[model samples]
Target: MAITSANQLELLQTAEAVAREKMIDPGLVVEAMEESLARAAKSRYGAEMDIRVSIDRKTGRATFTRVRTVVEEDELENYQAEMTVEQAKQYLSEPKVGDVYTEEVPPVELGRIAAQSAKQVILQKVREAERDRQYEEFKDRAGTIINAVVKREEYGNLIVDVGAGEAILRRNDKIGRESYRPGDRIRCYIKDVRREVRGPQIFLSRTAPEFMSALFKMEVPEIYEGIIEIKAVARDPGSRAKIAVISYDNSIDPVGACVGMRGSRVQAVVNELQGEKIDIIPWNEDLPTFLVNALQPAEVTKVVLDEDAERIEVVVPEEQLSLAIGRRGQNVRLASQLTRLDIDIMTEEEESKRRQAEFEERTKLFMDTLDLDEFFAQLLVAEGFTNLEEVAYVDQDELLVIDGVDEDTAGELQARARDHLEALNKAALDRARELGAEESLISFPGLSPQMIEALAKDGVKTLEDFATCADWELAGGWTTMNGERVKDDGILEPFDMSLEEAQNLVMTARVALGWVDPDELARAEAEAAEGDAAAQEAEA
Candidate 1:
């Protein structure tokens, strides 16, 4: 084949046809053809020679040129493509470094080998351009739903053609081993669109909680219009799911709107999910109230939440225990996921037994340490005094309010509690020292003696060790590993150390050790305060 006068426009026609077929820019296809022609020219002339190709966009006329650049003697490396300024002077009136000289050349005839190579190059470039076009079209479409045609199954993953391109629905992403035949039309949530080496990989999912939310948004007008917002979703894939929604308009009930008129809207979503049971719960600002809603179909007798620990305990009647936990713990697991909290569920009798055990333990602690009788300790516990610290630091008026307690008795109780707490602190400090805690860490302002002991046991025995710690390392936090949240137990977590508190202590240690500038800290604090004030003003 050759770029003959009769067939010159063939290149333009082919480029336009390929671009239209692949849905890519026609110019990109033309550029790919030019590059392929240039490579063929290089193979014919000489590999080291400078050869370039350009095609007229409108006329499809191909131009071939042999070019050389003038460079300094020391920089001239490619003998065929580059020449020194002195040598370049022969070709021009005044030659200068970095000047390029080009001359028209005869187009070469294509051989069997060269034509095959050019075809491969054009195909590769077209594939890349197609991938880029597909990615640009779908990148912003992630987290939304799209209609697709089932193309084929590869290793249990569905390769569905989504009009412009193909996306993968992994085996795990399919709900309940769902199978589809070729040419079957399906809808899927665009979980992610990533640019990979071979091409842009579009990951589709039906099991993601967001997939259900997307379905609801599509089915319910209120949700689509932003009148109702789906705040949280938890799915057992094909089995069951829980959704929490809130409505901005008081006239519209979020749950009722999501459920639709006689469940028409939710039923559409349910059909898509293979009849997965959905519990549309109204979102509550109160976490415990929301939890009660999340654990639906089971009457909750009580909900005790530990906000600091991000955990909640629910008490139910004996008959509801099995229902609340669901078949194989599915209900509770989805509820936990929906609430973003760890949950502990028990029957009311179990809760009562646990509460009695805690009361007995506290009573025993007071009896042994404060040197009080069982009856007095029970009275203190009944009045909500749980530990020696609370009793020691509480006002004398609080003690006087208890039955059979007056000024003298209150004073005696405070004195005993303070003495016992002091003794416990001393023992903890001594144990910390034995565990190799330095004076600097022991004297750290924010840490208690028990906290110091805990740190010492964990090898954070020095101020330097404490300063090098991350806030999350000192205050427990959750980590998502392999799609599950795992707790990272902190050394000082048991002492009720928050991340903020840990940060303050670490910064203080750094300042004391001359590692941080006090003036800089003050400036930073002032700047932060100013920024907060500005943000507040903007909000107002």
Candidate 2:
């Protein structure tokens, strides 16, 4: 029962307590120390020496055994004296130079080595266990907001202690007009949790799009409940941002709700972000409306959309041009991003100049390139004939009867009129189709594809065709399939037309035929009917 002093007992007890605190296995620590002591003893006592150490944990006592290998001859100085066959038999039945015979050694060497080895093993295990624990602690906390204190500045970024880990908040995440000092407390959204060689690494941001979004979720019940949706966000982080919001409930005003009363809701978010300005704009599908809203504080008079160019020409009053364009063009620049358009801002004066240039170009074409002779051109010009359609679609007979023309001239004018009139009429019909007039008319039963195609091809493309076809058989005995007679009332519905509508369409057709006075066609038809009635009255 050789018991060591109290100092030796204290050392061993401290080692055990440290192993427990650092979560290191006490058995592993003991095994590592034992291996180190055995190696140290062999080095000090010679390679052929065998040393065994035993520990008395309760009494803190340690003992060592020493042995020497038996040899056939004295090949090395440290080897035991060459044992004769009789000597080897007395010591061991079978002993070789590579094998050993043992005896108890002193406790001093084992005690000194065991204590040093245990200290080294415990320190290494503790470091590794701390690292593992930190990684596990931070891994579960990713994507959560955390409060942190600024520790120091490194490479223009803030090193913050976020409870279980150290986080880096980059410079760009700081508000433009706001800053932080060491020891300041701040709230940040956790962006990432990563493992590093030293410890758990966390990344934080205060300017991420989701930071504002998360704040809104905390402040607004609708956002948390998913009643409002943030469709898009264009942020000049730390200064201003445009958030396009939409409501899932039509009855709700998304922008108003996000803005809150007196802007308390959005203001809360802005305060968290250090008074960064936020604009909550309602999302609109209409490009013009959306662009107008995207450029806030700047009123737009008109937006000329050039979709093919992927640009819009915005006209603002002379005074508003600078405001709309913003300082350094930032207002329009952000608006362009928000609406996804290339905006060209123009003041009223510039726009007026553009319109004047266009007007002059068109005037030159009409005056110089148009086929009308100087005298007739001047007459048409005086009559406000800025476009050829004015003359081409006019009533040819009416123009021929305009006091100065004879029968031959009238015939020639009529021929020219017909050519131009048909061209203009065909162009108008093409435009109407483009404008969706054809789809609107397609549902009428009598206006079947075959009939419509026939009329379109025959140049009977107006409701005037109804008048011409009044005597023409539309179906069996002039009765269409709907049992409607080929009278005006009967055929109007098929074409989705009324009598007045039919008359107007005929007038348009007549004008396109170079008949300037469509009213005369109606008069001629009425006179023809009156003469027929008079002839019938005489016969009766």
Superposing all C-alpha atoms, what RMSD in Å does each candidate have to the true structure? 2.3, 24.4
Q: Give candidate 1's error at residue 359 in angstroms.
A: 1.7
**What tens-digit string does per-residue lDDT give for candidate 1 at 1-540?**
999878889999999999999989999999999999999999999999999999998888999999999999999899999999899988977999888999889999999999999999999999999999999999999999999999999999999999898999999999985779999999999999999998999999999989999999999999999999999999999989999999999999998888888999999999999999999999999999999999999999999998877889999999999999999999899899999999999998998999999999999989998888999999999999899889889988999999999998889888998898888899999999999999989888888899999899989989999999999999988888997878999888877789888889889999999999999999999999999999999999
TM-score of 1: 0.93
Q: Rate the local accuracy (lDDT) of all candidates.
A: 0.92, 0.66
After superposition, candidate 1 runs with Cα above 4 Å error: 532-540
Q: TM-score for all predictions?
A: 0.93, 0.49
Off by over 4 Å in 2: 1-144, 194-200, 305-310, 358-540
lDDT string, candidate 2, 246-306, tens digits: 8999999998999899989998988887777887888899999988898888999999996
